[model samples]
Every structure is written in structure tokens, then in C-alpha cells.
Target: MRKTGAVPVISGAWALPNAPQFSEGIAKAKELCRSAGGTFAVLNVEGEDEQSQSVLETAFRDARSDEWKEFLADCLKFEAEIAKEISIEKFTFAELEEEEQSLERLRRWFRDLKKRDALQLPAAEQAQKALNSCIDSLEAYAQSVYSAQNGGE
Candidate 1:
């Protein structure tokens, strides 16, 4: 699952005697997050198998704390940019003169994002979920606009 604005906490169970690939996946995820200006954490839990999981856990948790805040800020800024794109696309003269039906969808997405920001999502998962919802709304609006332009149902 994709996450935003905070370190992703990945938790799952896998049989022991696992190869380095599993740890590599975690490392790759962290590397990807670093590239995106975010953070990642993989919590490998296999039913109290502490001896086996220590290596993976130690590597995952070694992330610098200072990066978390910077990552979160970058993520939020990204979300805001997405929201602005929706606004610009939805309310454009072409869109306004074309598909009026989609205006409500775009307005609702903007309002929901605003409301959620005010409410403070309280967790990374919740914030990510909210961002996904915003994307869904925006996509739906775009689809409606395109469908109207093309005379498609």
C-alpha cells in the first residue's frame, strides 16, 4: 500500500528461513521513499521470532528522525499541489463551458480536502486515505468532463 506524509509501517508475517530478498524489499521501499522525499518503515513480525527478525528491524529503524518532518512537509505540499491542479482543471473556461455536471464533484473534493485538513487526519494512514479519496474524486470529475466532451456515457 502507498503512504503519504509519514513513515509507512509495514507489518506482515512470513515463514522463517527467508532469503535476503525480503530485507531487500524493505530497503528498496526506504530508498524509494527517500527519492520521493518521504520515509518508510518495515516492521517484520513473525510471531515472536525475535532472533530472526532483528537484522531487518534494526536496518529499517535506523532512519534519521530529522528526515521525517521534512518528508511530511514535502508530502503535504505535494497534496496541496494536487488539490490546486484539480481546482485549475475543474474551473477552467473550457471545462466550465463544457461539462457542468462535474462541477459538484470537484467542489466536493476541494471541500472534503479542506475539511480533513482542518480536522487533522491524526495518522499517516488516515491522511493517505484522505489523499486517495481526493484523487478518486478528481479522477471521477475528469472522467465526467471527458465523457461529456466526447458524448460518451
Candidate 2:
């Protein structure tokens, strides 16, 4: 995920088998936060196989500490920089004319809003499930094709 000014917390299983990759993820999150002038944190899960909802809650709370004042400040500061505003709702409609830019921006924002509204409907939830299934199937097929082309290497 692209980094913003928000504090990042990497929550993962740090088992011996995957400790290196876990450490790498932590390092990357730290670098992203530091580059964006924000602090970084981590939630080191003990059991590789065990998991819970609290970990997610704790990470979220950690990021939004101080009544969200720090996060708000960081976000405002980051959003002020012209070159770094590429997140959702942050797209600058770069290099467009004044009139076209405003129109396009509103159009995209409305489209996203409509999508959010649609996702709250039952039909959209069913469609999302079907789309996820199709994606998984396609991914498996692609992997099979790649493996075949590699002579089962």
C-alpha cells in the first residue's frame, strides 16, 4: 500500500521460518513513515498459526493515538505537498486545465461515492464474492500456465 502521513503498524507472525520476511516488512513500513515524517510501530504476534481480532484493533488504536491529533497533523502536512498527493481522493488530476480538472475530480469522487454506496447493497456484496472467486480462479490458472511453461521447474 502507498504510504501516507498516518502512523504505520506492521502486525504479523514473526516465526523463525519467516522472520526475515517479517523483519523486512517492518523495515519497509518504518522507512515509509520516516520518509513521510511520521512515526512507525509494530504488533509482533507471538503464534505463527494463532490470530485474533484484537491485533487489528491494537494496531489501529496505536496509529490513531493522541485523539488523532498527530495523525491529522501529519495528513494535513503531507497533503499540502503537491507532488505527494496520489492517494484516493488525493489525485490532483495532474496537468489538466482548471475547468476540466474540477469536473474530472468531482466525477471521480462521485463515482467512488456511488461505488461505496453500492457496496452497502446485497447485490453488490454477492457480485463482490463472485468477482473474488473469478479472480482466484484466474490466478490459479495463470500460475498453472507459468509452471507448465517453466517445464515444472
Candidate 3:
């Protein structure tokens, strides 16, 4: 018997530290689904699924709200502090020349955090623990931006 359920597909472009292009990411996800012998369907928040649409609308709306903007700003401050502690000069969450470079900067910080014996320090420990959260928040912010730009297409 074949499995029957919605298979969640995500594009690598949706990964953190990289700007998300929703149309391209969705296209890639659909292609992956097809190659895996599965069907793909785009979820439209304003479409037939009223309940799901309402939920999505609320969530996206909140994400675009001032609170969300402040949260992202705070996250960026945390990232910058971590970067500075790790000696990553000029570190920024702003889109860089190459997406990979932004990712590499995070990777470098993580590595330095691990190799250093000064994890007992407050700043180092904060930076070490914030790695995952930083990435997650960044990804969410990227998705919010994408949804706004594409009108959740």
C-alpha cells in the first residue's frame, strides 16, 4: 500500500541566511514532488480553505505588524553581538553579495563558539545558544517578506 498524505516539501532557498524567492522556491518544491512521484498543490490563504486561509492570514498579518518588526530588530542585535564576540567584523544580517557568504559567516561563528574554551563567559554562551534561534527567526522574517512581496501567491 502506498502512503497517502500531504508530503511537506521545502526548498533549500527557503533556508536561513538566504533571501527567499517564494515563486522560485515553490516551483522548486513542486519539481521535487513530481520527481518523487507525488503531486504538488499550492496553498492559497485566500482560496477555498477558509479555515486554513483565516489562520494563515492572521499569522501573516501578525508577522507584518510592528511587533514582528521589533522582534526581528532585536534578533539582529543579538546576531551582531554574537558576531562581534566571535571576531566577525562587519557582520550583518543584511543581504550580502553572495548568500553563501552570509551562511559562511554564521558557520564560522558557530565553529568559533565550539572551539573556544570561554563558553563560560556570558556573551559567548549567549551567542552559542542563540545559533538555532537566530536562524529560525531569520527564516521566518524572510518568509514574511516573501509573502508581502508576492501577496501570498
TM-score of every model? 0.29, 0.25, 0.31
Kindly report which residue stretches of model 1 are placed more than 4 angstroms away from their true locations once superposed.
1-22, 25-71, 90-127, 144-148, 151-153
Candidate 1 TM-score over all chains jointly:
0.29
Please report, in order, the local distance difference test score of every candidate based on alpha carbons: 0.44, 0.38, 0.44
Tens digit of per-residue lDDT, candidate 1, span 55-140: 54443333322333343454465456446646665444365343333434444443433332321333434445554654565566
Model 3: how far residue 99 lies from native, Å: 7.7
* Model 1 worst lDDT run, 10 consecutive residues: 1-10
Superposition-based RMSD of candidate 2 using all C-alpha atoms, in angstroms: 18.1
For candidate 1, what is the lDDT?
Answer: 0.44
Candidate 3's displacement at residue 40, Å, is 62
Candidate 3 lDDT, tens digit per residue, 9-109?
A: 24521111111323554566678888999876654324368885465444434323433244335557756644453353323334422333554566564
Model 2 per-residue lDDT tens digits across residues 5-105: 12233342221112332354457767877899986555454544335545544443443343234323433342233223222223222322332343344
RMSD, every candidate, angstroms: 12.9, 18.1, 18.9
Better of 1 and 3 by TM-score: 3
